[model samples]
Target: MIERSVRGEAVWIRLDRPAKMNALHLDGWRELYGELDRASEEARVAVITGTEEAFCAGDDIETLDAMESADDVSELAVELRRVLFGIEELPVPVIAAVNGLAYGGGCEIVAASDLAVAVEDATFALPETRIGAYPPYAVERMAELVGKKRSMELALTGEPIDAETALEWGLVNRVVPRSELTDAVSAFVDDVVRSPKESIRLTKRHALAGKPSTGDEDRIAGALARASLSEECRDATQTFLEGGGSEEE
Candidate 1:
C-alpha cells in the first residue's frame, strides 16, 4: 500500500508493504497514481521512498502469476508506464529517496524521477530478463540517463549494482551513508524548494526537451505481453516465488 503525508512544501509518498519488500500489485499502482495526482495539486516537491528494508522490490510475483493473457499483461504494462510518465511530467521535481533495494519497476521509478539520493547500502537492477520479461520504460529511460553501453549491461546482465556503482554509472545523483540518507535528502529538497518554483519547473521542462522520443510503447507492450504469457517466464517466476530462486541472489 501507499502512504501519503505532508512535510511542509514537500509531500512524502511511502510504499508501506514491508512484508513483501513494498512490491506493488495492480491495485497498489492505482492507489499510487491517485496519491500522486492529489499530491501534485498541493506540494512543491515530492519525495518517494519505502518502508523497512526496501525502497521497492518490483511488481508483486503473485499478481504476475495471476495474469492469464497477453491483453492482461499489456494493460498492466501500459498503466504502469503511464504512471511513471506522470511522475516525469509533474510540474514539481520528484525525488526518489532510495533507501534499499530497487529492482525492476522500482528501478524504472528511479529512472523516471528528476533526481535520486540513495543510501550506501541501496542497490539497483532491472532483472526482468532473468524471468524472460523486459522492462519497457527502462529500455528508453535507463539508456537516456546512463547511455547505451551501461544500460545494455544492466538490462541484459540481470545483475544488481551496488550504490557506489550506481552513482558512478549516474543512476543516482548522490549516495550517502545509510544513517545520513534522510538528512541528505532533506537538505537536497530544501535547497531545491528554496529556488523559485517557476524557475525550477521551467528548468525541468527544458532539460526534458532534449530527450529523444523512442515511440516504443506499443512495441514494449507487445514484448511484455509475449514474455508474460511465455511458459519460461511463468515457470521461472513461480520458482522464484516458491523459494527456488532468490531475486537478490
Candidate 2:
C-alpha cells in the first residue's frame, strides 16, 4: 500500500506492508512509481518511509527465490531498475526517511534518492546473494551512493550496516535521533519550497548527472518549464511576487 500525507512542502510517501516486513513485490514497484509521481508533481521534496519498524526488508524473497530460472530474476531486475531509475530522474529531490531497517530493494530505493535521513536505530543491507540471487539493480545504482567496494562487501556478506556506518559511508545524508526524523526532514522541505523552483530542479539535474558520468551529457528534462507552460509561469511568478506565503493575488 502507498500512503500519502503532507507536512509543509514535503509530501510523505509511505510503503505500508509491515506484515511482510514492508517487503515489496513487482506490483509494489508500480504502486511506488505512482506514489512518487504524485509527490514529485506536487511537492518541492519527498520523504519516503515505511509504515513499520523496517523501512523495507528488501524484495519479497519468497516470491523470487522460488522462481524457476535466472531469466526470471533478470526480468524482475529489469522492471525494478526502471522504477528506481524513474525515481532518480524526478525533477524534485527525494529524501528517504528510513526509520528502521532498509534492506535489499528498500536500500536500493534509498540509494536512488537525493537525500536520506536515517534514524540512528535504522539498519541497512543487501542480502540477495545469500538466497542464491544477485543485486543487479543495487549494483547499477547503489555503487554510486556508497562506492563500489562497500556495496560489494554488504551484498556479498549479507551483513547489515548500522545507521552510523551508513552515514559515514554516505549511504544516508544524515543520521538523527529516531524521534526527530520527521521534524528534520520537514525542515529541509520547508527550506527547499521557499527557493526558486527552477533552480531547485536544475540543481537536481546536475546532481543526477554525476551518477551517469560520461559522454553526451546534455540530457536534461523537467528542470525548466517549457515556454508553452505559461499558466504555470503565471501562477508561480504570482506566488513569488505575493511573497510566496499567506498573501493573496
Candidate 3:
C-alpha cells in the first residue's frame, strides 16, 4: 500500500488503500519499514500521507480474523515491532500527514512519527480492545506522544478523538482543512529539503540524544531498537567529501 515519489530532497510515501481504509497487512508493514528506512537515509525529509479519503482505519481486521496460522500472533508481533520502530528510529525526521481516520495501528504510526499534521476531520483511536487484542505497540507510542493517563483512557475506552482534541492532547502537531493538508505538508517538507542534510540529520540525532531506559528486557529492545546506520552514516561521510572534507567542517 506504499506509493513512493520524490519531490526534491523530500520523498513522499503514501498509503494507497482508501477502500480498505489503508488497513495494514503484514507485507504492508514490512514494506513500509523498509522504504521509510530508505527515505530516512537517502532523502533529506520523509513525508507520508494517505491516498484519497483515509490515512488509515488501522489493521485489516477481516484478514487478521481469517488467518489460522499457529504462530501468526508471534510473527505479526515481530513485524509490528519493526514497523512501529521504523518511524521512530529514523535519524531524519518522519512526518505523518493524517488526512483522515488514524485508528489502531494507524494511530500507532502517527504516534511514532516525528511530526504530524492532521486534517480538520481526522480522527484517532486505539480500538484493539474492542476487537479482542491488546494495543501494546500503540499504547507505548501513544503514551509517549500524549501521556499515560490520557492514553490509558483512549486505549481502554476505544473511543475516537477528534482532530482538535487530539491536537490539544498533543497527539498531532497541527490541524488544517483537508484541502490544505497536501500543500501545507508539501511546503513544510520543501523547507526541510532546503536545509543542509547534516543539519536535518543532526537535528534528529540531537532530538533522540538519549534513549529512554526500559526495565523490561523482552518488551523493550532499547539497544537493538534499531540496527546500525549504514546508509545515513555513509551518506554523511560522502557529504563531508563533497565539501572540503575535514577543512570544510
Clashing pairs in 3: none
Predictions in order: lDDT = 0.84, 0.71, 0.72
Clashes of each: 0, 0, 0
Ordered by lDDT, highest first, the candidates read: 1, 3, 2
Best by lDDT, which number?
A: 1
- What is the C-alpha RMSD, rounded to one decimal, of candidate 1? 1.8
Q: For model 1, how does the per-residue alpha-carbon lDDT over 32-59 read when each residue is reduced to its tens digit?
A: 8777877778888889999977998888
Segments of candidate 3 deviating more than 4 angstroms: 209-249
TM-score for candidate 1:
0.94
Screening candidate 1 with a backbone cut-off below 3 angstroms (N, C-alpha, C), the clashing residue pairs are none
lDDT measured at residue 7 in model 2 versus the true structure, 0 to 100: 78
Tens-digit lDDT track for model 2 on 1-249?
778898777789888988777877768877888788888888888889998677877677555433444455444555566567777678888989998888877888888888889998998888655444455556666767788899898888878889999999999888999899988888777777888889988898877665654211121111111211234443544443355321110
The number of residue pairs in model 3 that clash at the backbone is 0
What residue pairs are clashing in model 2?
none
TM-score of each candidate structure, all chains considered together: 0.94, 0.79, 0.81
Superposed Cα deviation of residue 61, candidate 1 (Å): 1.5
